[model samples]
Target: MEKTDVEILFEQIDNITETVQQYSNETYLDSLAVTLEVIFYQHPPEGMDEKLQEQLQNFIPQLDVSKYKTTEIRKALQLAMLKGMKGATQQQHLMTPETVALFVGYLAGKVTAGKKNLRMFDPASGTGNLVMAVLDQLETAGSVFASEVDPTLINLAVLNANLQKKEIEYFHQDSLRPFLLDPVDLVISDLPVGYYPDDIRANDFELKADEGHSYSHHLFIEQSMKYTTPGGYLIFVIPEFLFDSDQSDKLHAYLQENAHIVGVLQLPETAFKSEKNRKSILILQKKGPNTTAFNQPLLVQVPSFKETKAMDDILAQMNAWFAENMNS
Candidate 1:
């Protein structure tokens, strides 16, 4: 049988990344970045050894990146990135699961339905996977933005976005810091869970703890809200214990004052490595004139992905709820 586009592209990416890694002695991810550059530019960058350049030249013609759909391209790249991430030791380096990203995309599409030329931002765009997934689901020709603190991750994200022909303005700085950006119509992020190390900078945030390091996830929500236009929406994949932590009261107060909790959909336990890592999809609308809380917040317990029938039933219920409430 003929290979699917995603399979073909993943094989090409994997082969190129492996070849680059062998030649340059770079990590799998960094080598994949070089591979992406070569694929995108159709040539190895200047200063690479002649043998490696020749090898890359031989590989380029075999690639059929342009013919594939956006989702296929994303899937291919995501598979390659996931392979690289296997050897990574840092918790922050973890990629969002494709299934979760797709679900987020679906919810985003539903909320922003009928909107045109909307602006969106993702402050924790690791390798651009989640944001690109969201972009694929959107039916708008709007501005997109992302930020990341890690240089290697940001470089990969840039190359990933470029290869996919996504026009995203990226901030290669700490996402918690102030950005030279206008408030956006929507914000989405798979929030980085942990305590933020910078207490002094944490002082600038309303969600900052009164003492010691602040929970970075809390600060992320506040920062996302800050850059979301009044009446705009923010969607996040949040830790299940977000509202049960020692600092939950502060976060709760902040949200109550500034945004309305539109929904909280608990992701299936099977999706996570452990109960400690379980997360939920949280939707919030920034408080503004003419905006009111939903009559009944959307609260769902998502079924496991492996259970197709259960998943479909839950999605139908979600669709029905959205149709009833969001259309008004």
Candidate 2:
């Protein structure tokens, strides 16, 4: 059987990435960055060992960038990155599942429908996979922005966007820090869960804990809200225990004052390895003059993606709900 586009592209990426990893003695993640950089520039950088440079020069011409579609390229890169991530020890290093990214893209497209030349931002855009996935489904994406504090992730992200010919402005700083950006039309993130270690920075946020370190997920919501345009939508993959934590009361009150709860879709438990790791999608629309709280917020229990009939039925109901509730 002939290889599919994604499979072919993944093989190409894996081959070149492995070549660089083995030659340069770098981690798989770092070597993937070098692989993408060389691919994007169409040449190996200067100051490399002569043999490694010669090897990369040979590989460059063989990669026909124009032959692959953007989605195929993105998927291929995602596969290679996932391989790199297997050795990652930190929780923050994990990428959002492709299934969840696709679901978020669908929701983003639905919520922002009819809007043109939309500006989008992802505050915790690790390696740019989720943002790229969302942009693939958007009809009127205007300017895209993403922030990441980790140097290695940011480098991979820039190369990832460049190889796919995506134009994005990136901030290589802690996302919670202030950005010189104008408010954006939409915000999305797989919010990093755990306590934020910066007590001084924590003091600057309304959701900061009363005594100890602030919950990073809660602080992310506030920070995302601050940068989103009024009436703009924000979607997050949040821990199931978000509202049950000790800081829940403050978070609830803050949301009441600033945004409307649009929906909560409990992701299928089968998506995660354990119940404690399970998460839900929380959708919000920042409070504005033109927006009002929905009388019936969209509450859904998402069916497993493999259950085609059940998934189709749920999506149909969701479409009806959006048409009726969002038309106003």
lDDT of 2: 0.92
Candidate 1, 1-328: lDDT as tens digits: 9998899899999999999999999999999999999989988999998999999999989986899887888899999999999999887899988889999999999888888899999999989899999898898839999999999899999999998899999999999999999999999999999999999999999888988899999999999999999989999999999999999999889999999998999999998878887889999999999898888999999999999999999999999999998884
Q: What's the C-alpha lDDT at position 149 in model 2?
A: 91
RMSD of each: 1.3, 1.1
Candidate 2 C-alpha lDDT tens digits along 78-154: 99998999989888788988888999999999899999999999999989999999999998999999999999999
Residue pair clashes in candidate 1:
none
Residue 91, model 1: lDDT of 76
- The residue pairs that clash in candidate 2, if any, are none
For all candidates in order, the CA lDDT equals 0.92, 0.92
Clashes of each: 0, 0
